[model samples]
Target: MSNRLLAIVEVSPEARIACQANGCGHAVYKRIHVVSINGSLQVLGSECFKRLFGGAIGGNPAYSSSDGRRLTDAERRMLQENTAQLVAQLEAEHEAAQDPAREKLQRISQSGIAREASGGPPHRFRAPLPVRQPAAPRRHLGPTPEAIRKYEAQAKIDVRAKFDVDPNLPGWRGLVLQRITELSKSDEVPD
Candidate 1:
């Protein structure tokens, strides 16, 4: 009979995570994980057995996929699907092993809001409510629809007097020079 303890070893989806206390197999993908079967973790996949025991597994009785050609598309797809399933299974098992109550509580919390929490309408925004006024006679200097929409939505309320539109207003040159001076003298900035 196979080692009962060895049967429970399982591999994660990326093949890097191993379920069970004894993390075995060379790569994470090859880590044998235990899956419950018939109320016992004694289901050992043949591929994993071959990898672990090699020719000694069956003493060269049956055929070997090791001596086969490249894997077909079907095989590849199956591998991907199996990996995903195994990973999910092993992760669930791991969570059960490590603070199972926390995991269960997390699942319950993610099951959507309770009916008691739905007392009122969902909160939402009602900004710049589209109240299109009647259009006036054509004005040549009017902003393009796209430009007007863009600006309307994100109209810069540049309260900073630095960028004020007045032509004679002082610029940010003083601010820039002060920043440069502070940067040069301060060790606050890292290279």
Candidate 2:
């Protein structure tokens, strides 16, 4: 029962849950994930849970709402709808770029949502991924003729690699060069 989750409850719809993970305790909302291990329950805040456990919210059926019943189809649809609403809310809030609901749906779409058992729960609330800081923009080097040539040569090499050019084949170099020349223009090639 030390590291397991026997039960979890939502004390308040608008309140945060205190994380029970080792050493670091913090209040978290938005995505509360609970797990039962070794017959014990732990209420891990979103951050602690993500740092300790790398998995995101799943559609495991073992998890039930406070009412003890699994998610109804309507409830699942509502959750999806809420995600869409969150999108609109984000735009209104001027936070659409960092919308948690959008990120959650992206992750679900990529990894897919799973249920606990064949006949278990339909869907459960999942914690969203931690907010990511945007990466620094790459510096744009002006389109110098050297840069253009370099790009064109790289493209030709890529074409060669993709086709597995056999140097032994008759007219292989001619064919490759012809393709490259056909793709290039006087403006791109420069003087």
Candidate 3:
């Protein structure tokens, strides 16, 4: 269970958005929905959100007069195009609102005589942000394919040498033969 509340952000008449929940990465385009969690807003397709939270949510009341159903592919595409245009418009408005010099001039003008007499800009200082160091690279110590093959070849030679010297050596012979057989079958050392 997640301790999260569904706070719908932006709604469009035709657009859909992807779900924000973990492991439920479904694309939702019809009844495009957005929610806020921990003060951060996210766009989610409405149906999946309702399924997870469990409620009958009548999506976007502006289009409620029309039949409540999924959007056709053509409608979805048109809506997506509309949504893109809307997003571009909103971004332009936001950029206009974020003009620092205009905002500062407005603040100074509003302050009137005392600020005008001072002449210098208002005393506002911000500390330099901290720099982050990159992490160290990891070292791999595992044996390489060539090294493994060399070891196996050496093992086979040593085992054969021992067996050739004394083939009837009771305990050693069977074990050496087994090692040689295994070495024949594999190119690398066994774990």
Candidate 4:
């Protein structure tokens, strides 16, 4: 509290600097800023903050209730609303400047000679190029999960059926039978 501007560096807010090199005794709260210049409380900046702080109690980052604690959700929502409004104002300012800038560029282009030719050799024109259009996006195709599972199960059954050893032919191997069945269905492979 002792080092505070309102307490230690009491200066008339109307004047930028006090007549006294140490400090001023006036209580005016407009048109001046107080800074710790040279270890003394001197009016240096603008009093815009002082005048605005009265209405900006809710906007103050240091502001707290009588108990000096953090703000509630309502306070946070208010701050968000205020910030969004300020951003909208700044965006509108940028949007307004674009039109004048384009107009100025257009005027400069019309008056200026865009091309300068130092007569050496005239550039040769190339033959007409074919117009190319962008191709359509590709699509992926695949068997559905149920269909794939069914096909795999069928293949497994075929292997099991062909691999079963027949008692009539003692030399007949199930592996050989399976190979024959696979060769018979060679055309059945999917593209």
Candidate number with greatest TM-score: 2
Give the better candidate number (1 or 3) by TM-score: 3
Off by over 4 Å in 4: 1-121, 127-140, 165-191
Which ranges in model 1 have alpha carbons more than 4 Å from their true place? 1-22, 25-51, 54-56, 59-66, 80-191
Weakest ten-residue segment in model 4 by summed lDDT: 1-10
Tens-digit lDDT string for candidate 4 (1-191): 12222111222333223232234444432233332323443332234334434443333221121222222344323323453343234346546767799899786654443332444444445798998988987876555666554545455555557565442354644444454446445534343
**Per-residue CA lDDT of candidate 3, range 98-129, in tens?**
78878998876677655556795654557878
Q: Which residue pairs in candidate 3 have backbone atoms (N, alpha carbon, C) closer than 3 angstroms, thus clashing?
A: 16-29
TM-score per candidate: 0.18, 0.26, 0.24, 0.20
For model 2, how does the per-residue alpha-carbon lDDT over 1-191 read when each residue is reduced to its tens digit? 33432222233334444566899767654444455546444556556755875554333313333232222344333333453342233235445445788889887754434444455566666899899999999997655677566646755665578788763357675665564555553334434
lDDT value for candidate 4?
0.39
Clashes of 1: 11
- Give me the candidate number with maximum lDDT: 3
Rank by lDDT, descending? Answer: 3, 2, 1, 4
- The 10-residue segment of model 1 with minimum total lDDT is 60-69
Write one digit per residue (lDDT tens) for candidate 1, span 1-191. 34322222323444343322234333433323333323344223445554555544333211122222222344334434454444344455555667878878776665434422676544434687689999897966644565444433222222134455432236644454454344444523332
Which lDDT values do the candidates have, in the order given? 0.40, 0.50, 0.51, 0.39
What's the candidate order when arranged by decreasing TM-score? Answer: 2, 3, 4, 1
**Which stretches in model 2 have alpha-carbon errors above 4 Å?**
1-14, 56-61, 65-191
